[model samples]
Target: MKKTKIIEIKGLCVRYNNISILKDIDLDIEEGAFLAIIGPNGAGKSTLIKAILGLIKGYKGQIRIMGTPLSSFKDWDMIGYVPQKAAHIDRIFPITAYEVVGLGLKRGIRGNNAARYINNVLSRVGMEGYADKKVYNMSGGEQQKIFIAKAIVNNPRILFLDEPTTGVDIKAQDAFYELLKSLNIEGMTIVMVTHDIAIVNKYVRQVACLNKTLIFHGDHDEFCSSQNAIELLMGEHHLIAHRH
Candidate 1:
């Protein structure tokens, strides 16, 4: 059986000040699929994400989520997002990791249920012991995990992460990818924008390459074999791989 598409974009074009960033993008994302949007900087990758999130208006084309037009979905509570860069928070803000996670339950909190939800999310990210620690004192990876917990605390159906592993250590990157994969296995639709082809091949089931254009979108092996991908990444960027 063909899986139902959770996201559909047709003839999508985004422009800023008369400059086109994304051109004629048409794609479909199936439910529970892990899609990695891979491209170099200035690829209009971020613009595409913003368009899907409805953060950018006045774009020409159609975007639909879960069989409904993007504009029609007034309640976006089902979508969870993690930005590319973590914002700087005050060191002395007087907030604990638990409190940070608890913010995800901003809609409503009844009794100790909010606390339990926070604890469960933190435990999922392997930050069970750091719930009481100040956010400033925690390492970058730990802080990222906290943010992940915050994103998933509400049990969103679709999770969008932009460079979730950026600036983290190798071990942390591996663990973070594993966490995302586990969530994907548990029936979460994940759409992530990343420049890491190696990680994308390892963790994501599908890959899409963009460079102000939709170059290719398909399986990992096909992506690696595409001439367009090679020209975009290796030809223009001068990236070389030594094979014995």
Candidate 2:
């Protein structure tokens, strides 16, 4: 069966001070897909995501989310975002997990059941037991999970993450990916900007390589074998052998 395109972009372009950040980008992300956006530093990977989220505007192009034009898309709750390393958050701030997740709730979720719903979201990321603990006391991986819970608490249809695992311990990265995999299985499409090409092959269903333009976008198998991928990745990196 053919999948529906959850996100569609055409002629996407972004500029800063007359310098092109992204140019003529065209891409489509299917429903329920776990897509990894990879590129070198300063290659406009983050800019592309920000543009799609409508966080950074003044660009030229068409962007549609769930079949509606971004400019007309009023259902912001359907989209979840976990920025790079959860940078917007103060790592040492004294805040509980429950409170963090609560901050993401839609305006309608209030009164009696709101607290229960917040706990339920925390449980989704295996942080139910630590809801009372201060976020600053948790490890980097644990903090990441808390932020993820915040993003998902609203039950977003699509989740966008920017370098989510940057500060996480190497050993815990696998577990973190598994959590994201579970969310994808439950029908939340995921689009992540990452530098870890190795994990891209292991966890994500699709890959999009960007370097100020759409370099490549396709299944991992095709990406691994495509001449475009080889040429673009040449001298920069190599796709690691897929591990079971």
Candidate 1 lands at a TM-score of 0.92
List model 2 lDDT by residue over 6-108, tens digit each.
9999999999999999999999999999999988889899998899889886999999999999998999899999998683456568888888888899888
User: Judged by lDDT against the true structure, how good is candidate 1?
Assistant: 0.85
Tens-place lDDT per residue, model 1, 1-244, is 9998999999999999999999999999899989999788888888898899999989999999998999888657678788787534588687889888887764767568888888889999999999999987887888889888988888888998888877789998999999999999999999999877677668888778888889998876677677887788884444323222
RMSD versus native structure for model 2: 1.7
Q: Per-residue lDDT for 241 in model 2?
A: 54
Once model 1 is optimally superposed onto the true structure by TM-score, how far is the C-alpha of residue 17 displaced, in angstroms?
1.4
Query: How many residue-pair clashes does candidate 2 contain?
Result: 0
Please name the candidate that would achieve the greatest TM-score relative to the true structure.
Answer: 2
The numbered model that scores best in lDDT is: 2
